[model samples]
Structures are given as structure tokens and as C-alpha cells.
Target: MPNTIVELRDVAIYQRESLVLSEINLDINKGEFVYLIGKTGSGKSSFMKTLYGDLPLTQGSGTVTDFDLRALKEKDIPFLRRKLGIVFQDFNLLPDRTINDNLLFVLKATGWKDKEEMDAKIEEVLGRVGMKTKGFKFPHQLSGGEQQRVAIARALLNDPELILADEPTGNLDPQTSVEVMKVLQEINRNGRTILMATHDYALLLKFPSKTLKCDGSKVFEVVQKNV
Candidate 1:
């Protein structure tokens, strides 16, 4: 139980009073990589949002990085986020800023005050994502996969306990998606817990891990066929 990073029991997630997923039970341990798969409107996004404090959890109980989801307040969201990294379907980079600036902005907003330390962390994360040399480039100058790599780099800047990726490869071509996936896989290999929401079944086949599927308001694990 001590190594569990995310745990939910009898949990129900809702969006503006509409119950999305109910009676969910999941336990993710430290250094694990889990996949979330489902069709459109099947509550995968809602479930991910609930984990990162974007959506409120009104019933049952859940916890992420030791923060209780039911009792989480707005003021506590930032603190909660500091322990988690979130990646969106769209590469949410600032268009006008270079990749370095985009990463720097997050560091500063998250309370990084030292110039030297901020720069060091920015480089370190970019290096992890294999984008160290591209930091001076603007987001528009890079390909979709490159942009997503930058996004992943940004996510790793805080040394988060968990990385919640919501359809991260949704906008990329197949090859590009794999490239971005490698970055995430490498991060996971280095001990960062990952929960990725994806519709690309090919990825599931290629880089299979423990998968959970959202179907008809319930979440359950996908049974892997014996090879």
C-alpha cells in the first residue's frame, strides 16, 4: 500500500452533474506504466481529469500522490500538480515563446526562483526528452512529434511523482506517435509512473502494459490474450 501512487475505491467521476464513470477500482504502484483506452465519450478524459484535480470527485474515494481527491481544494490544486505532470492531447505550448521560455514559465509559475537552477532543470528535462538542442526553437518550427517531445520535457521539469498523459499522441502521425511514445517509455523506464490515455490500438499491441478500459460508465482491465 505504501508503494501505491494512485488508488481509487468505489469512485465515481462526473462532469457537471453527469456521472461519467462509476464504481471504479484501480491501484497503480510506483514506477509502473498503465494505459487507459476507450472510445470517444467513454470517460477516459474525465477519469484523467479527476486524477489531476481538474475535475472534482464527488463520490467514493480516490487519492493521487497522497492528496485526497474528495477533499482537494482549489488552493491545494497547485500543490497537488507539483507532484504530478499533465500532458494534453494538444501540444499546449506557448506559441510566441521558444521551448526554453515555455519550460521556464512553468518553472517560475511553480515557484522556481533561482535563475541557475531553473536553467539547469530546463536543460535536464529537455535532455531527457532528446530536445536539448531544440530549446531555442519555437513550437511552430518543430514537427508534431517534436512538439510533443517538448511537452513531455516540460512535464518532467518538476520531477513529478506521476505523469498523466491524456491522448498525447492524438495529433501525431503514426511514426511520430511512436517517436513521442519512446520518449514517454524512456521516462517511465527511469522510474516515473505513467498513465496514458490513447485510442491507438496499434500502440497497445506494440508497447503493451497493464491497460484499463472505460466502457459504458464502468472501468475495467483489458485481459491480455496469451501469445
Candidate 2:
């Protein structure tokens, strides 16, 4: 049996009282690279948010990295996030900190107390994303793509069971987008399951995978030809 990393059944996603997606049944298995494609307001972000606990799952049953969505508690959100890595469109790195400090902050916040272990982990993840030499640079010192790569490396610090990437290439130019995509592809190749939400159909053609489309308030799998 395939190990399922994310599963949702009869799920309804919302933002406040507004219903975003409904009757959503989906399964993302271990080592799978899945895409969530939709228009700007078609609930792709909301769907991703629900999985990562940014938005609550109030109308359905769901689980992410073994945490029940509906049953998730306030204190549990942090722990839940620790098991899952999240990459955002905005590259949410702390501008005031260097790349090394940015990653260190996460490790410290998550309870790593050993200095050597934390440094080793930061090195490993930065090397994975090809940012090992640039750790001393601040966010402003790198290009958009480079900054995004650092953000991706930060996401990997926890060795998450699943990665929830929301438009990771949204802020990059065409060429740079492909660069960041290559980094993500490499990470996924190494056995981490990734569920990325994006509207970039061009990327779909360049690097096709199992895709799900959110439309008319519903989510369903779409074959590559249809995507």
C-alpha cells in the first residue's frame, strides 16, 4: 500500500464564513509530487492552508502527516507544522537576519538545543538547496530566486514528511522560476512528498505530475492532457 501523506474526504474549506472548496476528496501519497492548480480565488491557497492548519477544517475529515485536521488543537498546530514544511509565494524569510540565522531561528524554535547539531542541520539543508556558501548573506543580498531557494532550504530543516508549497514560483521571473523548480524537484526526488499549489500552467507542461484542479468550488484530479 502506498503511504498517504495527506488525505481529505468530504472536506470543505473556508475563509471565515465564505466557503472556498467543498466535497473535496484527495490523497497525496509518499514520494509523490502533486500540483494544485486553480485561479486566484479558486481556493487553492485555502486548501493548502487547511492542510497546514492555517485554516481550520470545519466541515470534513482530513489528516496531514498523521494529525487529524478537524481534531487539531491550538497547541497542536505548532507541533503539526513541525512535521510539515511550508514554502510560500512571498518567501517569508526574516529580512533582518542572515540566511544562516533565518534557518537557525526555526531549529531553535522547534527545540533543538545542541549547537553542533543545529549547525550541521542548517548546513545540510542549505547545501541541499545549493545555498551553503551564501548563508552569511541577508535576504536583500540575494535575488528573488536565491531568496526563494533559501526559503525552501528553511522548509527542509525539519525533514518534514510532507511539503506544502503555495505558489513557490509565483514571485519569480520565467527563468528564475525554472531554477527554483529544479531545486524543488531535486528535493522531491529524494523521497519527500510535495503538494504544491500553483497557477502556472507553463510549469505543468515543463514538469508534469499528478495534478488536481480547483474549480467551481470543487477539487478533482486532472490528467496532464487536460491540465
Candidate 3:
């Protein structure tokens, strides 16, 4: 049996005395895809923050890719981030740089010393997302979907073990959302775990995977065995 990639045991989060999440217990194995659904301000973003170290772990224990999130040091965040990929609703690409430069910047920041290897990796991931020809283009030059593809490429540059997407397709049209879902699905099929927080029930019906829902100030595994 394989080890768990993401584990949250009795995790709790508070926003300056206001508790956002209460007792979130979960275990995500390698290569699994999960949907996180909830209302606005229902601690969905807070959960993502906890996983990425944006918010300090206030209670309970958690781990991502073997890193003890509760005991993680500040300097160790970069290392943990390398094992986890985070995607956003708004494509956070550097408008001033070309797509290739955007990816190269991350590689450099992550301590990549070989320029040739970085360039090769850039080309490889861009091709993987069908954006090989757009590496020279700036973020402003591409459509919404194209820019998002570049962001996805950036997230993939490190080849993370798991991808945490916070409303990845929230800003796109219906057709474009499907396209983005295809990209994410392909990534999952290739053996990377995906934990996407989405309000799109169509996506849930279309993809059909485990659903982890944030409700009643706690995160629960909503499934047939318990339903």
C-alpha cells in the first residue's frame, strides 16, 4: 500500500478569535482527486492556506508530502511548497515577462542552477499543456484561457506531488472551464494528486471523484458510505 500524500487530523483554524474551520480530518492518498465545495467564507480558502503554510496551524496536526505542517519552520516553507503546487482563480502571471521567463523565474527562485535544464523543463511543461508556441508571449498578449494555461505550466514546472487549486476556473466561461478541467484531468491521469476547490457542480458530475465539503464550521467526507 502507498503512503498518504495529504493528511489533516483534527485541524482547526481561527481568524483573530473567530473560528473558521473546526476539526478537519482527512487523508488523501497519492494520485487521488478531491473536490472541496462550500459557501463563501466557509473556510475553503483558509483550508488551502493551512496546507500551503499561508496561515499558521492553530490547532490539530497536518502533513503534506511528509512535511509536518504543524511543526514546519518558516525557512522550510519553500521546501514544502516544492512538493505542492497551488493554482489560483486569477492567473498570477508576471505581465512584464514572457511565459518562458515567468517559469524560469520560479525555477531560479527554487534554486535551479542549470540554465539549460531550466530551459528544457520550460519547453517540456509548456508542451504538456499545449502552450509550447506561446512561451514567448506576455500575459497581456494571451486570452484568458491562454494565460491560465501558462499559470498551470508554472505550477507544473516543479512537478509537484499534489496540486491545490482554489477556484481554478472561476473566472472563465463555461467552455473555457471545460478546457481548464481537461488540463487538470490530464494532469491527474498522469499520476499527480489534485485537490480542487470548486463551486461548479457540473465539474463534480463531469469528473466524479471524492468530495470533501466544508460545512457547519468543519470539513467532512461526504460520500455514499456515510450518506
Q: Candidate 1, TM-score vs. the true structure?
A: 0.98
TM-score for each predicted model, relative to the true structure: 0.98, 0.98, 0.96
Better of 2 and 3 by TM-score: 2
**How many residue pairs of model 1 clash at the backbone?**
0
Candidate 1 lDDT tens digits, 1-227? 77999999999988997899999998999999999998999999999989999998899999999999999999999999999999988989999999999999999999999999999999999999989899899999999899999999888888999999999999999999998889999999999999999999888888989999999899998875521
Query: Which ten-residue region of model 2 has the weakest summed lDDT?
Result: 1-10
- lDDT per residue, candidate 3, 1-227, as tens digits? 25699888888897778899997888999999999988888889998988988888879998889988889899999999998888999999998999999999999999999999999999999998899999888899999988888888889989999899999999999889889999999999999999999888787877788998888898988872332
Model 3 per-residue lDDT at 10: 88
Across residues 1-227, which tens digit of lDDT does each residue of candidate 2 receive? Answer: 34988889999888999888999988889999999998899989888888889898899899898899999999999999999999999999999999999999999999999999999999999999999999999999999999999999999999999999999999999999999989999999999999999988899999999999999999999999987
Q: Which stretches of candidate 2 lie over 4 Å from their true place?
A: none
Question: For model 1, what is the error of residue 80's alpha carbon versus the real structure, in angstroms, after optimal superposition?
Answer: 0.5
Rank all candidate structures by their TM-score, best first, as comma-separated numbers: 2, 1, 3
